[model samples]
Target: MIHSVLEFLTDELNTFIKLKVGDPTTTRIYLSGVTNEAGIAIPDQSLGISLINIEEERVNKDQQNRFVNAVGKVEKRNPEIRLNLYVLITANFQNKNPNNSSDDYVEGLKQLSYAISFFQSKNVFTPENSPGLGSFDPNLQKIVVELYSYSFEQLYNFWSVVGAKYLPSVLYKIKTISIQENAVLEQGEPIEQIFTQSQHKS
Candidate 1:
C-alpha cells in the first residue's frame, strides 16, 4: 500500500512538472525525516500514505482517494519499475499556523528552521545509508536544507502543477528525475530571486 502511494505521488508530481519517468533530471519527491531500522527516510511520499492510515480526516479524503487510485493506475501501466519517494515533515507550527497573516509568515520561517535542524540532528543522509549509491556531502546537505527553506513558492508551484488527471505524467517525471540535494535549487533560484533575476536575464 505504501509503495503504491509513493508511486502515485511520484506520477502526479511528474505530470504537473512536465518531467519524464526515469529522466534522472527533474523528478523526485521530498520525504520527511522519519526513519526506520533500515534508516529509510520517509518524506512527503510516506506522509501521503500515512495520511491514509487515518480514519477521521475526511476533509482530505478526496486527496487521499486520488492518491490511492493513482497507485493502481501506475501499477497497471508500469509494473517493472520501482519508483523513489521522498518524505518531508513540516514542523507542528507550520502545519497549524496558516501562512496568510504577517505573524504567521514570520513564524513559518522559524518553524522551517527548526524542521531543518531536526532533520540534520538525525543525520538524515549519511554515507552508510546513501540508498546504496554514495554518501551525500555535508555541504550539499546544507544547500538542500537552505533551498527547501527558502523555496516555499517553488514547492507550491511544483505541487500546484499536480492537479487531477495528470498522475501518469507525474509518475514518469519522478522516475526520470534524480533526487539530489540541490537539484531544484540548482535548477532555479529561490522564487523571489528567480523573479528578481528574470529582469536581468531579459
Candidate 2:
C-alpha cells in the first residue's frame, strides 16, 4: 500500500517538477519501504490500529556523490539558481481490529496535523518582511507556497479517498518532515546519521 503511494507521489512530482535525470536542478525523490511495525498502540484499545509505516529513504552515498557532481555542473551552467531538495515522510494508520472505531484514526489525523504545523513553523526560508512570506524573493515565495500548498492539499484529498475505500477507520501519523540545506553526505558516512543530525532542531 505504502509502495503504491510512493510510486504515485514520485510520478506526480516528476511530472509537476521539471527535471532531467542528470540535472542538478532536478530534485531526486526516493521513498523507503514501509517499516516493520505492528501498529500504533493506543491505551484502552485491546488491538491497536493497523498501520502502514512509510518513511523516506535516506540519501545514499552514491546519490550524494551524484548530487554533488550535479550541483557542480548546475553551478557552471546556472549559478544564480540555488537548488534545494525536500523530503517528507508520512505514516498512515488504519483500524484493522474488525470493529469500527474512529478514535485511533482521529489520533492519527491529529498527529499528521501536528507534523505539518511543526514543518511550517520551522521553515527557515520564510521572509522577514511579510507574515506569509515563504521564500526570500516575495514573488518566488508566493508561487512556491501556492504550489506546495495546492500539491499537498491534492495529495491529502486523494489519500483520504483511497483510505476511505481501503481502510475506513484510517488515521495518518506523520513523523519527521524535514528540509535540509546544502545536503551532501560525505563518503563513508552513513546516510542515516546525516538525516538524523539534520532533522534535529537546534
Using all chains and alpha carbons, the TM-scores for the candidates as numbered come to 0.23, 0.27
> Residue 200 CA error for candidate 2 (Å)?
72
Residues 6-113, candidate 1: write the lDDT tens digits.
Answer: 343334333333332234454233333333344333332112111211122223222211112322331111112222233333322222335445224354344344
Model 2 lDDT tens row, 71-187: 333111111222222333343445545465533676445444443443354433223423433222233331121112235565566446434322222233332223234443342
Off by over 4 Å in 1: 1-83, 88-103, 124-156, 162-202
lDDT of model 1 at position 132 = 22
Report the CA-based lDDT of candidate 2 relative to the real structure: 0.34
TM-score result, candidate 1: 0.23
Which whole-number lDDT from 0 to 100 does residue 157 have in model 2?
Answer: 68
